[model samples]
Target: MKLRIFHQTVYRYDRPARNLVQSLRLTPSVSEGQRTHDWQIDVQGGIRGPGFRDGAGDWIEGWTVRGPTEEVTVTVTGRIETRDTAGVLRGHRELINPLAYLRDTPATKPDQALRDLALTAKDAADPLGLAHRLSAVVSDAIAYMPGQTGFHTTAAEALEKGEGVCQDHAHALIALARLHDLPARYASGYLHTTADGDAHEAAHAWAEINVPGLGWVGFDPANRCCPDERYVRLGSGLDASDAAPIRGIAAGHGIETMDVAVSVEEVERFQTQSQSQTQS
Candidate 1:
């Protein structure tokens, strides 16, 4: 299947600030199951800065506006060709080491609740089964509620609250998988749902677990399903903070406000192929 994605983010500040810096990880890399045909990013208000060069994880930054600044808009548009491998991403190309994925971040610490959840899946024979079980457990345990957790929310905190958005769900699952000696990575992307029409919100997150034969398999605990062709893998890291689409700091502030919108549309399969052949 092929997909066309349009993501737009707007930031409005009450007072302009000085010395602002942001990291952006909005670019998508082609992999075995996915191919990038055409991708472009447009900035309206602020200047695009250099992304982090030396890092094993994805670098996310935002634009900065000096004091007396008001608004910034970032628009990203792209088209990608994807094949569904039953959530199996194969090929030996190692963009990220499996060992590195096994490492846990501060916000993904597995507390007693997470550890107990993993213990329930310990009897599974294979990694795929474990992933299935984990997805089911998380979907059943937590309600999808926004504003429940922020960038600082930990797995333990989210599990205790019993409610969070996709990031929280993904983080909890990552912690549990790592505790069980499974190498798991955090995936950042956009999810398009027919129920929601054309409204884009914050970035979406999920978890990918490594299997012996199949390599890495992705699971969206929030959606209660494995990632298929409809899913777009943008970037990945140990946790949501690492793979965040945008993050930054400002020097001076009187009051800051932020607004974000994202939209993903699945391009018609026939149209995508025709476009591909025309470009060729």
Candidate 2:
């Protein structure tokens, strides 16, 4: 399937701020499952900086706004041709060892409850099977309630509350996967939601576990499925903050606020219309 994406993030400060710097991991992953085309990132009134791929094979770019300004906007527009790869991340190059992801972050640290949950899936025969079972257990344990959790909510806290959005689900699953000694990390990306009235978040997240032979495989417990053609993988990190599409800081504390809008849609219909118009 061919998918088109538009994402805009606007940052507003009540008082003028200064010297803003941003690191963006907003590009789609280069893998057998997807191929990117015509991608662009624009930051209003900002100077583009150096870009490089990190050890985890994620593309990162830096931008700076020499601001005594009040507002900044980041816009991303892109298209991707995607295939269903059964959630297996293939043909992606990285220097980091898989075991590196076994380390924990504040948002994914497992507590006693999480450890107990991981133990339930201990009887699984192999790493891949265990990963699947762990995802299932998390799906059943946490109810998807949008406002039930916050950005800093830890895996243990979300599990105890029994409700959260995709971020919480991914964090909880990562924590559980690590408890079983499966190397796991948080993945940030976009998901195409259809007209079926499903409440899937267009800006989404999932957990990727590095199985022995398979490398990295994605599991989204909030939706109770593996990542498929409808999903576009961006980057992976220890947790959400580390994997955030955009991370930046302002030199002056001017009390900032942000608003984000994202949309992902299949482009086949749009292409067909363009073709018809050209022929006519």
Best by TM-score: 2
- Tens-place lDDT digits, model 2, residues 195-265: 89888779999999999988899999989999999999999999999999999999886789999999998
Runs in model 2 lying further than 4 Å from the true structure:
271-280
- Give lDDT tens digits, candidate 1, residues 120-199: 88887777788788878887777788887887898889889999988888888888888878899888887656655423
Score residue 51 of candidate 2 by CA lDDT: 99
TM-score for each of the candidates: 0.83, 0.96
lDDT of 2 at 153: 94
**Pairs of residues at least 3 apart in sequence or in different chains that clash in candidate 2:** none
In terms of lDDT, which candidate is strongest?
Answer: 2
Model 1, TM vs. native: 0.83
